[model samples]
Structure formats: structure tokens, C-alpha cells
Target: MKKQSIKKTPAKTPVHGSKPALARQVRIIGGEWKRTPLAVLDSEGLRPTPDRVRETVFNWLGHLLDGNWHGVHCLDLFAGTGALGFEAASRGAAQVTMIEHNTPAVRQLEATKTKLNADQVQIQRSDASTWLAKTGAGTARFNLIFLDPPYHQNWLGKVVPLCQGLLADGGLLYVESEFALTDSADSVLPEWMTGWQVLRADKAGMVFYHLLKRQ
Candidate 1:
């Protein structure tokens, strides 16, 4: 089968629908779902992880992360519209727990969860920080965890450690940041990266992608 490309459209972008005035497609980025479209959220500026970024993140993850979809349990922090989690589900992940706080985004996520007919996904409408801390203890217990917060919040530092307890040994963590790597350890390293490989740091324009392995 031919592989489909990931496409990005602004949130609340209008499209046509038979049921009413118009509808939008959330659009899946990988697996049999590549190029698949769902509805758009009426939320403000919900960017849905750009296709290039998503593709690159997953590309590196395939090499660095241990699990290839199946048997893997994922945690998607800031899971806007359920993109990363749903993509993982489509790629064969056994389970995905998604956390998002925005009501419109959450509503869209819930809608997507139902529309995809996805059974492997668990959706939660909760604050990213609270959920990560509440979910796990300090053992590094997840196969994958995604962290992509709103750029203005400068939240990466505080939230990363909260997620550490949930990451399993040899687990992989992918962080999408709007800022470049700062000089201080306090600025970037997730408390969970205490013994993990720094792996790689790739930056493009305003976006920074860090790949870390939980040792």
C-alpha cells in the first residue's frame, strides 16, 4: 500500500458536510490511517502538531524507542484533538492515555475518540501537570510519553518530572518545545532523565525536539 502524507490545517477551519453548514477533518497522520480526516475543533489556535514535526518525531522514535506500537502503552500530555495518541493507536499501540484541559479541545478529542472507533485510547479531560503526577510513581514506567505545551506557558520544566514516574524502563520521551536549549539543567532535563540517554536534540526555527531514553 502507498504511504500517505500528514497534512496540517488550522483549527476550526471550515469544510463541507451533509448534516449541516460545514464540517472539518482532523486527519490521521500515520499507519493505515495516514491521510485519514476527522472533524476540526472550534478551539482557538489548536495546531495539532505540524506534519513535518510529527513525522520527524515518530521517525526518530522508531529508532530510539523500544516498542513498535503493539504492547506499548502511551501517555500523551497536551493531547490536542488526540493527534499523537490516535496516531499511535493507528500505528498499533495497545493503549494510549490522553490528557487535555481545554474544553473545546477536549470535546474535539472526545469526538475524535468516538469517530475513530478507537478502543485502545483512553481520554481524560484534565490538567497535564495534575494527571501526570497523579498517574504514576518514580519508576520510569511508560513506553512513550508526548509533551507539547503552549509556547507561552514555559511549562516543560515543571511537567517533565511529573511524567517521569509514569515512564517505564528503556522508555522514550519526546518533547516539543518552542524555545531553544537553555544552558542550565534546571531548564530542560526531565527529572526522569536522571539516568537516561540525552540521545539527540534537533531544532528547527522556533521549535525544538528532544529525544530522551529512560535508563
Candidate 2:
């Protein structure tokens, strides 16, 4: 019997209705790893910065970073998804330490570090306030600090002073909260936050983001 030859055809692309499901990931908006997606975990108060907000915050720090974050130390107090720290590392930060006490979130952050092979990034499974209290300014001072703790839990009040003390001269601090801190005179800042001043502020939905600088 003679054998017959069969032709091969390429697989058809799935239609819109059969599109692949989107991954639960947040992307790096700028720097070398732009658009690299980091997985998001199921954890309480794990809100990653929205792309627009992240872009705005980086743009505000453009002059400070001067296109490179080399030699800069950064701290993400409530890392959650490691978005802020990873973004800082991608932009050339010398060291980016992220602190998250939640078990699942810490695992997620570790997974991201492994996936990115981010030598500059460090994930610490510790409470934000506890870490701040233990680390004195002499021990570790950061050029940029991210204070996006779980909203409405008074975490800011607990860590603001510690973070301020840990900021180097002319260091920048980025804060995100549930309500606008600029809404009223009393809402501006606590009495001890005298050396810090808001450089930029904006609102996206209920979130109020601020970029502050230490004198």
C-alpha cells in the first residue's frame, strides 16, 4: 500500500470571546523593566499603585533621580505587592528594601524577586512600624521612602516620625492614603512633621497621593 502525505496547518488565533484570561499582575511602568508584570496576591489592604499614579509619582521625582537612581536607598514600608520597591530597583536604586508582615504578600514579594532576579531588591517579613522603630537613622537612611500602609488604620501616625528620622537630607517620601491629607489645615500633617513639605499632591478616586521632601 502507498502512503499519502498530509499537509499541516497553523493553529487559528482564539477569538475575542475565547481570549486568554488576564493575569493578576501589576506592571513596572518605567525604567529598564518597563511593563514587566509582577504577580498580585490575595491579601488584605494589598492595593498596588495604579499605573497613572505611579507614572505621576516617578515624573515628580524625575529631577531628584536625574534619570538614574544609582546609589539611592529606598524603603517600601507596606510593600504588599512589591510594586514600589521593584520599580525603584528597576530605575537603578542601589538598595530597595520592602517590608510586609502578611504571609501571603511576603511570599508574593519573594516570588517577584526570584522572577526578576532583582539583586537590588530585598523582601523583609516584618511589620512596618516595628522595622522603623528598630532601625535608627544612623543604621539606615533612605533617599526615597514609600509610605503606602493599609489605609484608615492609623499606621501613618505611627510611622511618620520614624520615617522622617530615617530620611536622608533632601530625601523624598511618597505617601498614599484613603483621604486627602490636604483637605483641611488640621489634616496637613502632625506637629512633628515640621521638616517635611509636600512637593506634589493629587487625587485619583478615594486615594490621595503625595510626594514630600525633607529639608
Candidate 3:
């Protein structure tokens, strides 16, 4: 009798229309929502600022503001997971407007806002660039602006200049980029970065986070 042959089954692949999994959760490291966890969506290029980085950044801000977040108006250009914006709100920022173009991400932001009962938070569903362009200078100015757009898209070049007009004098701008903004021979500062001074900067893995103030 001939031996029977067996067939092997191929591994199952993710269905095309299935929803993406929740990537992970990041907690508010300080303020009213301290230790509160926010859900992060598994979207391409979505990088939530790590907890350690945020703690350092906020420490820098706290020192600058003398530990006062009152009356601070913040704009999160690429609000991704609402980590930065919400953090600002948690710290008592007067207002926090979060810009997110992705639908699911926007939904999550709304849900988080509702959960926190954060009346100071505002969720806007629009592309950051378009929103900035439509928002006239002097009409709105934030004491702190968070610019953590997706990396390597020249988003800094496009939005940094616009942020100049939206940033109040003596305000702070927190940025996360793929590379350090430097004037060294190997790495030169982009033209848009002119007129800004890097007050504090540190690196975590491949992230080059900086806190800047306009000259």
C-alpha cells in the first residue's frame, strides 16, 4: 500500500479590513491626571512621546514657568495620542487645542477628553497645516506649542515657521524630531529654525527632543 501524503496549512494572515490593535498605553506622569493611562492606536508613524521624555520636558517647563501651568494656552499640532496636549491640560493649562487628522485617532481623543472631563481640552479634526493656515496670526496665540509631527516628512520645515506667529512672546515650543537640529558641520540647522534658541534638548533612542524659545 502506498503511504498517505499530508498537506501543510499556511499561517493565517491579518484580514485586510480588520481594525488595528491598540499599540500601548501611556500615562500622564504628573498633574491632576497623574498615573492616568491613555490608549494609543496602532497607526503607521504614530509615535507617542515616551513617559521619560515627557517627564524631562515637563520638568524643564515647570522650572521655566515656576511650576505654574495656569493661563497657559497650548496647541498640539500633531496630537497623535493626545499624550502631550493632555499632559499640558493635566498640569492646569488654561486651554489645550489638539489637532488630529486621523479619524480613529480623533475618536479616541474625544473619548479620552470625555473620560477626563477635561473642559479645557479641545479636539479638532483637521490636518495641522490646513488648520494653521486658516488660523490667522494674532487671532490665536499659545503660551506653549507642542510640535511632534510624524518624522521625516519635512513637517518641521512646513509648520515651524507658521508656529512663530502663533507662539506668544516668551512662550515655549517643544519639538520631537528624527534628528537633532544643530549648526555643526555634520548637521546644520534648517532655515526655519532661525530666530529660535534651544533652551533644553536631550536624546532618547532615535528621538531628538528640544524645548525652544523665540529670540
Q: Give Cα-based local distance difference scores for all models.
A: 0.74, 0.84, 0.93
Clash-forming residue pairs, model 3: none
Q: What 10-residue stretch in candidate 3 is worst by lDDT? A: 14-23
Q: What TM-score does candidate 3 reach?
A: 0.89
**Could you tell me every candidate's TM-score relative to the true structure?**
0.76, 0.84, 0.89
List ranges where model 1 is wrong by over 4 Å.
1-26, 38-45, 65-67, 136-140, 182-196
Whole-model lDDT, model 2 = 0.84
Residue-level lDDT of model 2, residues 26-103, one tens digit each, is 899988889998887756778899888898888888776787688799999899888888988888889999999999
Model 1 clash pairs are 25-38, 26-38, 27-38, 140-167, 140-168, 141-167, 141-168, 142-167, 142-168
Off by over 4 Å in 2: 1-23, 183-189
What ranges in model 3 sit over 4 Å off?
A: 1-23
Q: Count clashes in each candidate, considering only residues at least 3 apart in sequence or on different chains.
A: 9, 0, 0
Candidate numbers, best lDDT first, in rank order: 3, 2, 1
Cα RMSD, each candidate: 13.8, 9.3, 5.0
